[model samples]
Target: MKLSPSVTIEQSETGLEFIKVASEFCDATIFLQGAQITEFTPTGKKPLLWVSQQEDYQEGKGVRGGIPICWPWFGVSQHEGWPAHGVARTGLWRAEQVKEEENSIYISLSLPMNQIDEKYWPHKTKLLVEFILSTSLEVRLTTTNLDSETLNFTQALHTYFPTPAIEETKVDGLQGSKYIEFGEGPFEQHDLVSFARETDMVYTQAQDTQRIITPDGIIEVSRENSRSCVLWNPWIDKSKRLSNFADDEYHVMLCLEAANVLEDSVELAPGDKHTLATSLRWV
Candidate 1:
């Protein structure tokens, strides 16, 4: 992997390799495992991304924060004993390109299709993730079908963000959309989303833009080629059972994932391609 002047190769505490990116606009840390980005902070602002302090950073393990890529499938898998959220998160990805631009730095990586287990992902396809780091952060996940038959899959850029206090953070722009929670009714959102209990809501026909209003300020989140979004906060009971997570951590962090899920899952025909993208900035 060729490195640009703004990007350097670094290794985790557990010896896993990653890319350390520094530019005039922002700084970031991207791991080769899962090609996951664990950090992104603009020139002189608080971080726009968050991670668990207890994350092990172990080999072939998923980190507990930032933008973890969920591909091929989302949530529980239909196949018995198959890993939930598919295999892309822990699979090692190869750095394909890096270029420093005047405004934003571009970094690209690809997962080797042969590395995937046939039982889990048998279809012929190509997977790539590209990152644009600047004052704002952008991540794009692309899937290209090479099989003769059509294929369908669900995915999400599972982004974790920080808040001074969960009670003080609310999300706007999802109002009027239909959603379901814990297999419950397809309720419609009538107001800006606020956290009061264990929240796990999957929204379809969601607006492309949403604003996370925190005590500090508002962070604008937008998606491309996505109308499905998952808003999750483990609140109290489930937090104790989570790994690489502190029990009380729920008070400071939440996930507003940009996803292709439920009725919005992707369907690609032979020789077709699709891209799911998410971008964020303080507004």
Candidate 2:
């Protein structure tokens, strides 16, 4: 496959192929399998994304962090023994196009419906994930339904960000949004969200822009075509049970995902399309 300047096809130690972007504006890595972006850092800023040190880059497995494209569905499946957070995160994607501009590199990847298990995703749909790497990281996932029947589903750009201290981290701009945590309480957010124990909150009617305040700096996160998002930190006990994640690693990472979940879930008419997008920049 031909790549443009500042882009190269690289393979993980486990032989998983990925696209590496090293331009003046940023440096990033995106695995073809799952189309997962595991790294992104602007020229003089610390990393804007985070990946687990225990994450073993291998085929048929999603990387622990960066942005995992949870598609067809989000969270647990109603079917027995299905993978949580959907199959798109573990499926391979084909690079459809790559374009480089003055300060950005855009790489578009597509997952063929045939590559997905028929039992999991029977609909005829086109899934494309596009990465715009520059001074900041921009991700856009577009879903186009080619089937004759209408489609309904939930999805998210499950993004993990890094902080020097999780205790000092607070997320602002969700003050009035509604959230359901541990599958309970459509509680209204009253103040800046702070982390102490394990935090897994699904928020709806969230504002498009949020500020993640960390000791190092603030990260400005903006969403497009999404009113719902997920905020997570495994804390202690659950961190020990998670795969591809070290127990102590939870102290420095948090996920603020842009999603279409629950009441914010997507419904597409035949031949319709929808795109979920998010942007992150260190401030």
Candidate 3:
């Protein structure tokens, strides 16, 4: 396998690991953690995409609130260190396969051991995450629980979109329903509000997909297994402290997550499998 000097890649029993990211958008990295896309830079007319920064936690990173992956609980489950977001996300995975396809590269990462899974989840579960980059980006995640006990989990492909300005952006696909709005203030009001400021809103009973329109282009999001959708943009001064983000990064991006969590959780019985996928085709 050819390794890019821009990233630090390590081998894991379950999958490949990306320990460091030090490149411009053109030379980005991917990690075993949820098969997360760390940085994306499109050449020529191509668009630069950064996987949802939500997965990596910092006091204030970017407008990309969280990479949308929920299990047991959305943020922190009752289990705590397992972290409501689940340990699999941050856990090191093994790179099982990599192929250079037509327009992009196809990379696959799988979980290391089913034995370690028994600590938090009662069943034996194996996870496979694939990253397909071509004209746009595609991510496919599959979970197979081998043990007799059923597996319950929640997740989302939290995506942070970059734009010239937030004022010039509008997200489609969640037009008809009302959402649970978390206000501009920290854990502020739960009342429903339009897209503005630091907002945490979950759109329920949604269409299978949606789109974010920017003056420069459009980001189309479609999914198979995600039921709930979260739209977030932590505006105001929250953009300053992040390491990689610019001071006014919030002015340039919006967060649209592909998620299935809480009431929308998925159940997998022994020998049963479930698949969830999302594609970001830029136009």
Candidate 4:
């Protein structure tokens, strides 16, 4: 793999390995441990992604920001004692391909079943995350079922975005969707969403696009093959209990994930494949 002059492999202080990008248009970093992209900033603009300043870049742990690949399942495990957001977030993935274009860099990483514990996900599956970095960041997570039977799963490109202040940020384009939060009703979103307290909402039958209004600018989040989305912010108290995150960090970060959860979970037949993708850009 011949990387672009702007891309290089580097290790964190804790010996965690990642690919760093420093191109003329943007700068980014992605760790191989989880294939997680931790930072993205376009030239002459505010950062598009938010990473925890208190994050400990240690082995076998998910970094506090960027896009975390939630696979097999999105939230709490059906079985006890299993890791939340599934094993793909912490499983080491192998970089299989890298191609640099005139204006963008492309990287593909693969995670086979052998690299994960069968206890968490007992199926023959091949997961690949393709990252396209340019003026904007785009991610495509493809899952192939190698087993003979049907396989079911839920997933998300859990992306965290930065804001000047949480209270001042608003998310648009969810007006007609249905959502559930904190085991509450499937309420109808009649207007643009704004935050005051902690908010965790799972939206179904959502539109394919959304706009995040931040002080710096408006970020357009678009998705494909995804009918469900998650919006989350662990404000104040919950932020205090989170690992690798500062308590006040919640005030500057918000998550509007591109997801397939609830009634929209994916079911694949033998030898079937599915791709869930999302693209982000500041306008």
**Runs in model 1 with CA error above 4 Å?**
none
Pairs of residues clashing in candidate 4: none
TM-score of every prediction relative to native: 0.98, 0.98, 0.75, 0.97
lDDT of 1 by residue, 1-283 (tens): 3388789998877999999998888999999999999999999888999898889899978899999999999988988988878899989999999989899999999999899999899999999999999999999999999999999999999999999899989999999999999999799999999998999999988899999999988999999998799999999999999999999999999999999997888999999999999999999
TM-score: model 4 vs. ground truth? 0.97
Best by lDDT: 1
Off by over 4 Å in 3: 1-28, 46-48, 51-73, 114-118, 183-194, 237-247
Looking at model 2, residue 149 earns an lDDT score of 97
What global local distance difference test value does model 4 have? 0.91
Give the clashing residue pairs of candidate 1, or none: none
lDDT of 3 by residue, 38-64 (tens): 555544444446433433333212223
C-alpha root-mean-square deviation, each candidate: 1.0, 1.0, 6.2, 1.2
Greater lDDT among 2 and 4 belongs to: 2
lDDT of 4 by residue, 1-283 (tens): 2266888888889998899889898998899988999989988888899999998888888888999999989899888988889899998888888888898989899986687888778898889999998999999999999999999999999999999888999999999999999989799999999999999999987899999998878999999988899999999999999999998999999999999997899999999999999999998
| Candidate 1 local lDDT, residue 127 | 99
- Candidates' C-alpha lDDT: 0.93, 0.92, 0.62, 0.91
